[model samples]
Target: MYQQNGEEIFVIDGHVHLWDATEENIDHRGGEEFIQCFYDYHTTFTPEDRQWDLDEYRKYGPDRMVDDLFATAAADMAIFQPTYLTDFYTEGFNTTEQNAELAAEYPERFVLNGTFDPRDGDEGLEYLDELHDKYDIPGVKLYTAEWRGDSKGWRLDDEEAFEFLEKCLELGIENIHAHKGPTIRPLNRDAFDVGDIDDAASSFPELNFIVEHVGLPRLDDFCWIGTQESNVYGGLAVAAPFAQNRPGKFSEILSELLWWLGEDRVLFGSDYAIWNPDWLVEEVLEAELTQEHRAEYGVEWDVETKKKVMGENIADLYDIDIEAKRETFRNDDISQEFGLEDHYASGDPAPADD
Candidate 1:
């Protein structure tokens, strides 16, 4: 929980992962390149003192992840958005099974979403079923840009992709999170295209489409599509770190999102390990829209909007009762471990200083 103007803001990091890029896990040269690329991004945005060395970045494991996210009470909850690049890693980069290690132990602290690859055909459908049956996943994190054999990737609007979408509808999986961020190594740039989302979102109005990274470098395309589809949303992961070092760009990006998609459609995320929420949350919460941006965009990054972006909007999607969770957290295992019982004792504002 984040305290601002004496008000407690329950934060739900909307995008996160528990991945392995260890040398032992690397199968192809692409695996090495991939983690390096991610490290570049990490160092680019992260503060010098807070940055982790490349060796630690490859595989931070689950225990350290738990401490980083919760010990300081930076984020109230987080979602596990898996990225399975099996073609690169021997086992997998970050599979549903791998993430479940921590999610299962602290079910109340995390929402684990599964993934699907349309290229697998019938077996892919079966795998999706298996994930849903075993985990009862309420959502899926898709990596359309992931590689498999000779094929580079698939599109969200592909017929095979639609088949998987239909199955999701059948199984009552409603949240569809797609990675439309910057291109990573071994993945085709065209594969991360945001155009497919326009058709997919229209075709499945029953499901909610959360475009991760807000299709950076393609923000306009995504914003146009977002305007047409009522259920389309923006997940701020790669963009959120900008508040730390690129405040101007962050203001512009967030202003455009607010102008085009409105406050209810934008969600905050730290993309953990890549950027720790402990400090990232404070930077973002404290950031302000520039005077020029506020004037031109006619939008305010106010406390109310911050509340929605930080947690309320996502809570609405995941059906999380913030108040109820606060009550439960007063004595939950995590609270006991972190000594945060006083943080959730009541929702009242802190007393004014004398």
Candidate 2:
């Protein structure tokens, strides 16, 4: 799980979340939007300690999970989203307030990515403007896996959504995190197949949408989408299946992805808070976990490609200025900039002298 033991290499964790009732922005709200309606929230495969209930979730007390996420030094930067919109929060809730609060509390540890729900119409755009204009959120996350494709016979690239896409383009922001193409049977829903990427990328050349995960079962087609469009991109954030399915073939597929999307285009995401850090990072590091992959997957893990997938790609894509931004955050010095040191365990939180 520790990628490096000494060096303070900057890391950018692409996906993570923060929710505390005590916090200013994450407080209760009433709205008729997807994010808002899930107020009575609880994770599936419920924890053994107690049942899952959004109403009762806070009653257990604000968990230390988000703090753990912030305290961990391995993740130098994290862009997280709420687990979902529930009754506790509103659909119109923009990350601006959350990031502003986080930036004030633990600025260096947190980053912002705006949410877009087409169902809310102009209210969504107004919230997005507040996030971008006031909070400086660099990218947007569209949850097609959950919020979208609800109407009868609606395609992923519907006209209304495309208009929202134009609003994003006008805003000069398109680092979109789209949960595309999960297997239908897996979620047991009318799944949006892999071909959806092709349609979106073809129609919108101005947007920069990074299809999170490899789109499972439709990896080849998704890769093709990354191949054919300059605006299209892909990340191996949830690439564990690819590794377990054909561990030997990881290099081949990853290398092919490198060839198609170029190294900088492929991103890295932990999707943590929901998933374990050790497990997620290891999953991400799976494909290139061995020496044999230099030829098969190109370069090695912890080298340039890892940098690209994990941090560099997104930084460049989003034009993020970490150092400049860090000055304004609350805990720029609580942990080592980056390294394997037990920043939390030690009193000084310093790397070892020897």
The best candidate in terms of TM-score = 1
lDDT of 2 by residue, 179-256 (tens): 764422224444555566677777777777788766655677777787787877776655533454456566666766
Q: Each model's C-alpha lDDT? A: 0.92, 0.55
The residue ranges of model 1 lying beyond 4 angstroms of the native Cα positions read: 185-189, 346-354
lDDT of 1 by residue, 244-295 (tens): 9999999999999999999999999999889999899999999999999999
Q: Clashing pairs in model 1?
A: none
| TM-score of predicted structure 1 | 0.97
Prediction 2 TM-score vs. true? 0.68
